[model samples]
Target: MSLSVTKKRSLAALAAACLASVALPATPALAQKVKNKTPAAEASASSVDYVVTIPSVEAVQSSMDEATITDILSGNLAGNAAALAELDATSITIPEITVTLDVEVDGETERGTLTLSNLVLEDVSDGVATSMRLNGSSFATPEGNADMGTISAENVNLAAILGIYGLVDAGASREMQTLYTDFLVGGGSFSSDEFSCDIGAISGGEVRGRPFETSFVEIISIAQSMEDNPEDISPELLGKFVRMYADLLTAFESSEFTFDGLDCAGTTDEGEALAISVAGITMAGMSPGIYPQLSFDGLSIVADDGTMALENFTLKQFDLSSVIATLEAAPELVEESWFEANGRGLIPAFEGFSFSGLSMDIEDQDNEGERIIADVAEFDLSLGQYLNGIPSALDTWARGLRVDLPEDSEDEQVQQLLALGITTIDAGFRIAAAWNADTNTIDVEEVSMSGVDLASVALKGTIANATEALFSLDMDEAMTAGMGMAVKALSVDVVDSGLSDIVLAVVSAEQKVDPKTLRPVFAGLAEGTVVGMMAGVADAAKLGSALSSFIAGKAKSLNISVEAKDDPGLSLEDFMMAEDDPTTLLGKVNIDASAK
Candidate 1:
């Protein structure tokens, strides 16, 4: 049996418990009710336990003649809400207890034990208990065992859990209902024959589950009882389950949770030791339109021959307000025809996501000693002001992306590149844009890629007459939209910090000459070529002068821009046709050029 299953069965057994004849401690408020008297001392004539004979709920039935309870009924399964309402005590406490379950594993039955210390159910009001707690908890099975420091829950919906809602005013139903305000689990550990884990504290708050009015446990019981053909489910059954999904954002509107740390160690199939560790994960501020911010600072995977590590990761501003709103407007979308009507439209608004300091190192002995390694400083994407599930503004970038090339390479190109002190393409890249739906225009703010000690070239432009038809699937419609767009403004800017000088050096090295001697020689050749190519242009000499100065290393930057004279400036189709004729294209627009 899995550790999770053992935990559930063991806890369920204690939930349907053993009554001890002893006085138990209570809070200051309930202290008056528990004045050194036994738990049943105040038990009215209405007190009764009806769910006396369920399988996992029966603790001592497997090894002994009966459970730890004082009495046993032969054939009842669960109690009704009416029976639950008869309880009059402010609290119910049980001594340290142990429950054994007959676990099924590999078609055979084995033993699992769940031990809980000093369990308490307090602040009974209506048909619910306001809180529940246990000092310590542990679950043990043949496969593995887990021990926890403490377990507790506050504002627990006891009525729903005890099957009170299974039968409602109308009669029996299947709508599942569960709600709780806060839940906490202290440090814990799990160990098996080949693997072991150490888990830190966990916490949850403002948790809302399925909004259905039915009982949660009964739904599980029905699902478990189904033998075969479970996939051949009815639409009504599917709809009921789907409606239960709509309440998630509405449930965790103000919920927050955290995981402190987890460290697990095991072995690979070849018996090589491997371990995984994660720490400092927190999530907060989850609501309909706002996604919870989740972040972690430490994570790593280590093996005998390799390791992977990350400094931090964070994701936030994933908004599902539109999806939730769409469902509320047409709850029928969750029914049998979900895919056609609703599933395709479930795009969440992405606001931001990022990670930092990622590194990987792997040495594979099976692949002739080949190694795979990488280091990335940061990567991020951010967007805002969504329209029709599209972000109106977006910015994304990747910085310091790097990977090494082997020194002993088979390819001649690799050897030549390495001979020039070039290894990996350690570079950064960025692209940013904004769309104005009201104006039918898009502004590409910036697009650039830059390498270490290399050149940076950026392009920015504005396009007008961009319409919703551009988002269509039909090729003809999209093509028509593209043809209709006009260039409002465009510019290219280049910053050659060292790329030009390095290229000159490479050429000089091949020719056995000094790079300083080639600068002016190459510059004059470039200028003469440019003027010859544009002999008939009005600004040929001026453009040639700037190009020559830039190549001679006398100028480190070059810029060029094209701007429309008026509205409906230059259509892309017209620009493409006239692109080969510089004189005609220049006559249609204003050109700006400079070098510095």
Candidate 2:
């Protein structure tokens, strides 16, 4: 039985999105806000609790487990390891799916585990058709449990052509492979170190108009204690963990599933830990088609760290718009090299859908070893090219038909803009800190970048003692302070090799000081000598003047000058930072220090 064309196309789209990803930074797992509710008051709230709704859960689940379809295309049995085209019992009994959660909670400690069981899958296709179902499911937690969730399915499949898992050859198997690949390309996977559940179910209308089907059921841990201590959640480790899970989830959502409904619930031993529950959901493809519309009623997460447990926790909607916008913003993120390495037989549409919006919290230990709790948000994702009209035969024949060109027309222009944007970024994050008792005062010593002010850019010069050099100026405090703190007295000496001649020069300035005072502030200054010390103040002043003259002579030997009224312009040392002279764009400018 040959699958229809629509099913095949749907499957291809799913596969493309999955396999072509490259350099996808892990998404940190954290709750996002729902639109309708007021920002949950932070007064008693110590953690975020969020609820999410999903639609077309069954359709999406089918696509998530497309690996079964891939097995069919690659000439293998379903879950039992039977040969492709061979008949296992048409119907195999699948156990009911159950999720068990175990948790331990103290005043400030939380730990838990979730177990899933009884997941059944059916073999509905021999390269011609595919289908599956989800039995009744329930959840059990240490605190309590629920039985209000159900998993269902509908008609689904990818393009007809199938052969190898990623290779598209022409034949019955090839057709099956193509369809399977398509579904996987568009659909994604739900995987975890503790558990994994994926079903690739491609859905489309049949000749007789029968619908496609697929579904999923699984368990997730509510919370856990860090290896070091309950209060010490390693931010670094937590960040990495959240990012991995988020990336995997994103890959699944982009696949063939159009979510309809999803419900999840869990609780902890201590009421202050957190309680999360979600149900009623919907989702749909970007464009209109038979693809299911996914929606969820309510999804929520509550965090109680002996502080305040977040109430009315909700993740109303997944920001698909933001996902799409990110793709549009950075296409190179999904390169052909990445698609080739990971995508193999996937389509181009899935090439560059960037994965983002992962967040987590960890215990930050200070130098003194006191713990400072902080939440870190991480964005790790990638994007790639989109396939349009198939290229010419010659292009395909020269190598494989895989297209490596940029998806957008203005790729070069966009890259240039990105480069320019970061040029001044480093000059932004410098600070000077002073500690007084329990309080610390940090002054902005330089520039600030990223708004949060985490790092500082030091304008260091690596001059090779060149007679003349130029550089760019970043409008920051380091540049300003260095100029303001110039000495009030100096010396100069210039030696000209030509004619074997030498010229000596001196310069001085007085700092204003009041005469009438209990302790007179010294008015004149010299290098390595001070005046106005009690009875011998006259002799000290004379000695200070002689020292000042000598110092002035030495300072005058070197010529340094500041350009007047130069607003954010390039400086002399700027050229030293570059491989080529910046002045090449404007020609040469001379410097004179003869004191005339």
Candidate 3:
């Protein structure tokens, strides 16, 4: 049969069962009650009581006939003899149903009782029969309050039930067939007091499932055979077989294994009513080799008034080992080129973990207050490489880093700085590196950050032989080697123009420091430094004379460019470490500064 047609028939059967369970008893009684309440009738007793009984399968079929069952199916399975035949012998007997009402001048009270002794369905053609028996199931309200007794279902075969409705096909697996054979639940009850309502075993109420293939009979027989003939079954073979059976059972066992309790209520405390509740919950799932099994242990929730909390909420077997293994097994899952460019088949994994005690509170708010507060006492996560490819990954990420900023903005701060004679504000940085796997040489590319016109500074340089310098751990050696390495390009651009004077004026005005006093301090420091010495010579040779003049407002704009000679670098080792100013080594660089 087509899947859709099968599903429609299955749903029709389900709907019929639900309707029979609820509406069948009330329909006739409600019609009679309405007839008695008409104006033509005289006044009757203040209360009425009635009892109903649904007869056995054969008696009900004889009374209702084929048309009645077809009507109950709602035309969804019309003219389908096989489906109707399945329901013909299905017996649902309510041995006794009692409903009573008491009417008074001030108020009225209604109570009801429903007792279902057993519901049995047998399909001789399919060679399957299932039965459900409930004990002492009842509902009542005394003094406008509700109370209920324990209800338990026994001998439920879910697979057979589904098969009767044609929901299970012939090709169903052994695992699927075993799901419903011998499923049982017991010790289920609910009660409520003036202050609180409690549900006992609401979490499936001690559910147990014994599949047909793994029946107790088979298990006992295997045990007895092993005991009777010890030499026939080797210890290793026995252990292996036991393990296999355990694994198979776990794969088929998907129901919640256990649940403790649940309670909810609204109670008055300090003349104020507040809602509160607490529940202990746990659940498990089966995933064969990928996970083998997974579960949440000691999971619970509590809430009262303005606060809610989760306690001992732990998840087991949430690690990525299985995921990595799956990916490795199916390399085609991710594009090969993408993995090669990025991680080169490397993946990250973490050890298994658990987190607990998460909470949130809605505090009482005043005129201006935050609505909620949340906290976590501790959070710990650690990352580890599944393969030895950390260095390559780091290098790839470093070389890809780039920071781009706008050259101009209309923000109030930018306008204010512009009013102080600052023009372009393009400011950002980028990092580049080169790694040669063949030679094992690590040459870090140029790292540069530039401010176009605000401070007019540009720095560009490369770090060569970085691996050796970094490993030495000697700052002086690293520095000497760095300075001696090749310089691709180096330049500094500054337009002191009135920016420095404007800044001095603002700082002096704000801090009451005299500009005359600060300027001398800056000029003295400039002349005493090696950089200052270079600047003095450049200015004397008129290399940067135009730029200096423009900063003094002699020209409208200025641009300066400096170049290092063929062997130019630095004499810092002799100057700083040896305390000797090596002028000749410094003269290797040349500067050419000018204005437009």
Q: Which candidate leads the pack in TM-score?
A: 1
For candidate 2, what is the lDDT?
0.26
lDDT of 2 by residue, 1-596 (tens): 11111111112222222221110001011111112112345221122221111111111323233334333322222232222233232343323211111121222322222222222335434423244333333333333432322232322222221122212222332111112212211122333322222322233222111111100000011122232234554554443333333332332222323332222223344433443433332244323112233433343444533211111122222333323333233332334343233331222222111111212232223323222222222211122222121110110001011112222324575344333232111111222222121221112122212221112112211111111111112235435533332111122222222111111110111223322221111223432334433123223444444444433332222222222123233344444543474433122222222211
TM-score of each: 0.75, 0.24, 0.27
Each model's lDDT: 0.63, 0.26, 0.39
For model 1, the stretches where C-alpha displacement exceeds 4 angstroms are 1-90, 96-111, 123-131, 153-183, 204-241, 289-291, 329-338, 364-368, 388-392, 410-416, 472-486, 535-542, 564-589
Candidate 2 regions off by >4 Å?
A: 1-131, 138-270, 273-596
Ranking by TM-score: 1, 3, 2
Q: CA RMSD for every model?
A: 10.5, 23.9, 21.0
Report RMSD for candidate 2: 23.9
lDDT of 3 by residue, 370-435 (tens): 334444433322222223222221111111111221224445775677655554333434334454
User: Between which residue pairs do clashes occur in model 3?
Assistant: none
